[model samples]
Each structure stands twice: as structure tokens, then as C-alpha cells.
Target: MRCLLPLLLLLVAASVAKAADFAARFDDLVRTATPRQLYALLYDLPKGGDLHNHAGGSDRPEWMFEILTDPARNGGDAFYTRARFGPETEPAARYRLIRRRTYEQLAPAARAGYVPLADLSPAERIAWANAFRLDAPGEGRDEFFNVIWPRRGDLSQNLDARLELLVVNLQAFAAEGLAYLETQFGLDGLVTPDGRALTPAEAAPLIERRLAQPDVVATGVVVRFQDTVIRFRPDAEARLSEIYAFVAAHRDRWVGINMAGIESDPRGRPLRFLSTLRRLRAQHPTLSLSFHAGEMDGADSHVRDTLLLGASRLGHAVNLIKDPDTLLLLQQQQRVLVEINLISNRLLGYVPDLTQHPFPEYLRTGVPVCLNTDDRGMWDSNLTDEYFTAVTTYRLSWPEVVQLGRNSLARAFVQPEVKAKLLAAYETRIAAFEQKYGAGSPTISDALGKVEKVKPVTYGYAKRTWGLEFR
Candidate 1:
């Protein structure tokens, strides 16, 4: 037994040494690789899952434009945008970019201000595209929370458009090497082109049929959903109960419940839902909870309070560092995971200077953390951009990068068998990636040549932030 103990210790030490060596090599590559090469490598790197994604917010503007403008895909629905607001325009509608049913109800002057989405001039097209994202210099949380979602307007109510967007995301994520997605998707409030509302039961089958299509299956990405409720609504508790039941009933695809809203809203305080959550928990089978907590300008107990509401994961726990007790608890327990959205936080003004983000602190101190694209479409970014930001900003080592991917899958609210398969697949991919990029392999220039062939897709954020443009 004594001899075996020494051998085991020696084996562990060798494993640590090997990991450290790979990390050193990865650091060297990061230091030497140009912006473009680094981006390509990150883009090609295997990712585990996106746990904090929003279905509507994650749709790329260009993708949405293509789908919306196509009558065949959009169910013959015509959308109009307020290209130029008039004095008669309601204050709320002044900046709204698109409307469907409401366009006909507007006053003549207001109606005149709107032009069919397909009829927009060249400059209007650029403006419309820019309006969907936080691309301007001074745009922040108010512009995002207030204007961005409203701009979608009635387009968001279209069931076909939403389903098409999901397929687009699946293809995009697959291209970038993502293995799993747990998007926060809602089936409520959907309508046909003529504005006939559909029940959840009716909307769900359409989603199922679309997902079962050969194109969706070809992506090979495991997809699950969490139905979200705006936390600040007056009937949020009732809504939470309803969503809880809905998720339980639809456990085949929907696995969790999430509470999302602007964190600053006092009515959405985390503790307010504790009683309702406890009551619901007693009735329903265990459903995963991931609440948006600590995503505030000022720090408080929201992160801790959210844990009390039975959340196993916290979304945008940006201000979690402020609560010492909670931080310590997380570090020790290592039970809950924090979904970190770097670009989202920076663009939304939560962390204007990302160097000050608490993500590294959480990661280094033993709290489970994973990088995610919270609203990648609005940020005009992708999962690779998040990893690029983390690596360059934090100088993460190779082992750290691998750990992040492992953490994401480990913490995902997925079936046990699915999780095991994903983890195994991730390990295999990581091993192959390491072999491809390891020492004594192709020269960096050769790597760059191969990466250029891949023709990775980039957007405004990539070009603006890192001066990288792969088109």
C-alpha cells in the first residue's frame, strides 16, 4: 500500500508537469501569433456549451434581415420600420425600427414615417442593421434595454421567424465548434402573419418539427431550452409558477427555468421569489434554475439571495465580487456556476472597462465559471470572441482554457447520459486539438495558411475590437 501511494503521487506529478508544459507552449503561441492567427485558433477551438444565451437576443442582425425580408420564409409577412419619426409619433415609437400589425393602426403621419423593411434605401439598410446592435460609441444599457428589443417590435411575435433564427444559430454555432446550446427560448406570445395568437402547445410542435429537420440534425449540436420570465413583471411569481410547470411538462426539450430582466428593477429583487420558488419546488420535479443575478452597477446580495431561490447557476453575476460572504461560499462549495458574458457586460455598461471584470477572480478562487455569449447578436460577437477576450485580457493558460470548456459542460442542465457523452467528446476533441497545435508541428505561418482557408466569420465587434476581419 505504501509503495502504491508513492507511485500514485508520482503519476499525478507527471500529469501536472505535462499540463504545465502545454500551458507554457500555449502562452508562447498567444504571445507570437498575430491578431488574425489568434482569432482563427480561438475560433477553431472546441467549446462545450452556451448556458446563458437568449433566443431573440442571440440572432445576428444580418441573419434576421435575410429571413424577415424573404416572404417565403417569413410567411408572407411584411414588416415596416420607422425610418423617420414625425411629431405625431408616440414617444415610445420614435426609435422603434420595425412594426407589423401596429403599423396599420398608427396615425397617417406616423404610418408615413414607416417604410417597408424591404424598401429601405442603402443607407437605411446600414442604419437598420446598426440599430440591432450596440455598435455606436456611446450606446450602453439604456440604449440596449430600451431601444434594441423594442426595435424588433412585432417581428418577435412571428413563430416562423423565431424558429428560423434558431436554426441559423445552430448552424453558426456548429461552424464555430460548439457542442451544446441551452438557449433561453419562450413559446408564448407567438402569432401568425394575420395575428392569430397560438398556444404553447401549438407553438411547441412547430419547434419540434423544425428541429427534427435534416438540416438541423446535420449540425450535430445538442440543443435544450430554458423558458424565461421577465422578473420585474407584477405577476412574476405567477408567471414563474406557470413556466415551472411548463418546463416540467416539456422536460423532453425544455430543461430549466430562468428569470431575466434588468437587474436594477427593485420589483425584481431576488428574495421576492423565494417563497414562490419554494412552493413550486415542492410540487414539481426538480427543474434547474438559473437566475440573472448581480448584473448591477452597484453590488448587493442579489447573488446570494438568488442562490436561496434554488438557482444552481447565476447569469451575469458581474457584481458578485462585492459580496464577500457569497464569494467565499461559492469558492468553498463549488456547487453553483456563474455564466460570464464579457462582451455583453462591456457593451451594456456593466463593466465599461473589462479589465476590472470579476470573472478572473471567480475563476481563480475555485468558483465554477464559464464564458458565454449572453446576447451575441446585439454585441455583434460570437463564442470565439468571448474566448479571445478572456485569453488576451487574462492571459489564460492552456489548462485554464480546457478547464473553462469542461466547466461549461459539467455545469450544464442536461441529461446525465447526454452530459457524459458530451464530456467524452469534448475530451477527445481537446486531445486532437492539442496534438494539432503542439510542439514540433506545422510552423505558425503554415497554421495561418490553414486558418485562412477556414475563412472564419467575423462581425463588427471582432473588427472594431481586435482589428480582425475575415468577412
Candidate 2:
């Protein structure tokens, strides 16, 4: 027994030594590589999943333009935007963007103020596209929360466009080496081409049919969904009940329920739905709950209240650090995960400076945490940017990067067998990555050559933040 114990100890020591070697190599790469090369390396790195994504909010404006302009893909839907506001424009109709269906129903004078999306001049098109994202200086949460969603207008009613966007997102994530995606894909406001509201049951089959297509299957991205409820609405409780039941009925593809909306609103407080959630949990015990908690500007017990409502995951737990008891609970239990959205928080002014973010604290202190692109399109960024931000800002070690990826999958609301497969794949891929980049491997320049061939798609955020331009 003593002889076996010595051998086991030797193995453990060797493993630790190898991990330390890889960490040193990763630090060297970060120190020596240019911003572009480092970005490419992280872009090529294997990632587990995106668990806090909003399907609609993740659609890039370029993708939206392509889908909207293509008649065949968009189900012949026409879109319009207000090019000029006049006295005839109603207070609500003064939004910058609108759909053709909504434009048609507007007063003639108000309709005259709008132009077809395709008819916009080049400059107008650029301006229109820019409106969907936080591209300009001084743009923050008010612009994002007040205008961006409303600008989506009636596009949310088009199931075809939404499904196509999903496939596009899958392809994009697949290219970035992500293997799983758990997006919040709500079908609450879907309407038929002729303007009839469809039930979630009716809309779900369309989504199922679209996902079954060969194009979607080719991406090799395992996709699951969470039905979302806008918690600030007056009817949010009823909506949550309906969504919970819908999610329970659609466990095949739908795995959980998420409450989203501005967290600072008193109406959307975490405890508001406690009784409803408890009643729902009594009958539907298996459904997972991941709520938007601790996203406020000030300290509060929303994180604790969200836990009280039986949430196993918390989105944007920015203020979580303020609640010492809850933070300690999370650290000791290590059961629930905090979905950290660095770009979203920064863009929304929740954390103006990421260096002050509590993510590093949460991670180093044994709290389970994972990086996510909460709304990539709005930020004009991707998963790679999130990793790049963490590595550069926090100086993450090799094992820390691997653990972040693992945490995302481990805490995902996916089936056990699927999660197991994903975890195994991630382990294998990350091991290969370490071996390829660690000491005594290829030259850094040669490694960069291989990385440059990846051709990661960059946007305003990458260009503005990192001066990275990808062709």
C-alpha cells in the first residue's frame, strides 16, 4: 500500500508540474503576442456553450439586413424605418425603425415620414444599422433599453426571420469553436404573415421544423432554449405562468425559464414572483430557473430573493458582491453559477470599467462563474472578445480559462448525456490546445499563421476597442 501511495503521489506531482508549465506558456504568449494574434488564438480556442444568450438580441445587424433583404428567406416580409419625423408622427410612432405591416396601419401622414428599409441611401442605411447597436460614443443603457428593442418593431412577429437568425447564430458560433448554445428563444409575440397571433404551440412546431433542416444540422451546434418573460410588465406574472407551462410542455428543446427586463424596476423585483414560482415548482419540479438578478446599480438582496425563488443560475449578478451572505453561500455551496456578461455590463453602464468588475473576485474566491455574450449583436462583439477581455484585463491562467469553459457546460440546463458528451469533447480539445501551444511546440509565428487562417468575423467593438480589423 505504501509503494502504491508513492506512485500516486508522483503522478499527482507530475500532473501539477505539467499544469504549471502550461500556465507559464500561456502567460508568455499573452505577453509576447500582438493584440490581433492573441485574439485569433482565443478565437480558435474551444468553448463549451453560451448559456445566457438572447436569440433576438444576438442577431447582428448585418445578418438582419441579409435576412430582411432576401425575400425567399424572410417570407416576403417588407420593412420600413422612420427617415424623418414630423408633427403627424405619434409619440409612439416616432421610433427610428418599424416594419412594413406597422407602417401600413399608421396614419397616411405618419407613413409618409417612413421609407422602405431597402430604399435607404448608403448613409441612411449605415445610420439605420448603427441604431441597433451601441456604436457611437455616449450611448448607454437608456439608448439600449429604450430604443433598441422597440426598433426591432414588428420583426419579432416574424417567425421565419427569427428562425433564420438562429441558424445564422449557430453557424457563427460553430465557426468560433463553440459546441453548445442555450439561448433564450421566446415565441411570445409571433404572428402569421397576414397578422394573426399564433400560440406558442403553433410557433414551436415551425421552429422545430426549421432546426431539423440540413443547414442547421450541419453546424454541429447542440442548441437548447429557455422561454423568457419580460418581468417588468404588469401582466408578467401571468406571462411567467404561461411560459413555465410552455417550457414544461416543450422539454425536448426548451429546457428552462428565464426572467428578463431591466432589473432596477420595482415591478420586476425578484420576490414579486416568489409565490407564483413556488406554485409552479410544486407541479413542475424538473424545470430549471435562471433569473436576471443583481444587475442593479446599488446593493440589494435580489440575488438572495432569486435564490429563494429556486433559481439555480443568476444572470448579470453584478451586485452579488455587495450581499456578503449570498456571496459566501455561492462560494461555499458552489452549486449555482453566475453568468458574467462583461461587454453587456460595460455597454449598459452597469460596470463602466471592467477592471472594477467583480468577476475575477468571484472566480478566484471559488464562486462558479462563466463568461457569456449576453447580447453580442448589441455590443457588436462575440465570445472571443469576452475571452480576450478576461485574459487581458484579469490575467487568467491556462487552468482558469479551461475551468471557465467547463463551468459553462457543467451548469448548462442540458440533458445529462448531452452535457457529458460536451464535457468530454471540451476536455479532449483543450488538452490538444495546451499541447499545441505549450513549450517545445511550434514557433509562435507559425502558430500565428495557423490562427490567422481562422478568419474571425470582427465588428465595431473589436475595431474600436482592440483596433482589430479582420478581412
Highest lDDT scorer: 2
Return the TM-score for each candidate structure: 0.94, 0.94
What does the lDDT come to for candidate 2? 0.88
Go through the candidates in order and give the clash count of each: 0, 0
After superposition on all C-alphas, the RMSD of every candidate to the true structure, in Å, is: 2.9, 2.8
lDDT of 2 by residue, 138-180 (tens): 9988888887877788888888888899899999999898999
Q: Cα miss at 410, model 2 (Å)?
A: 0.5
What's the lDDT for residue 397 in model 2? 88
- The parts of candidate 1 lying over 4 Å away from their true place are 1-21, 87-100, 105-107, 439-452
lDDT of the candidates, in the order given: 0.87, 0.88
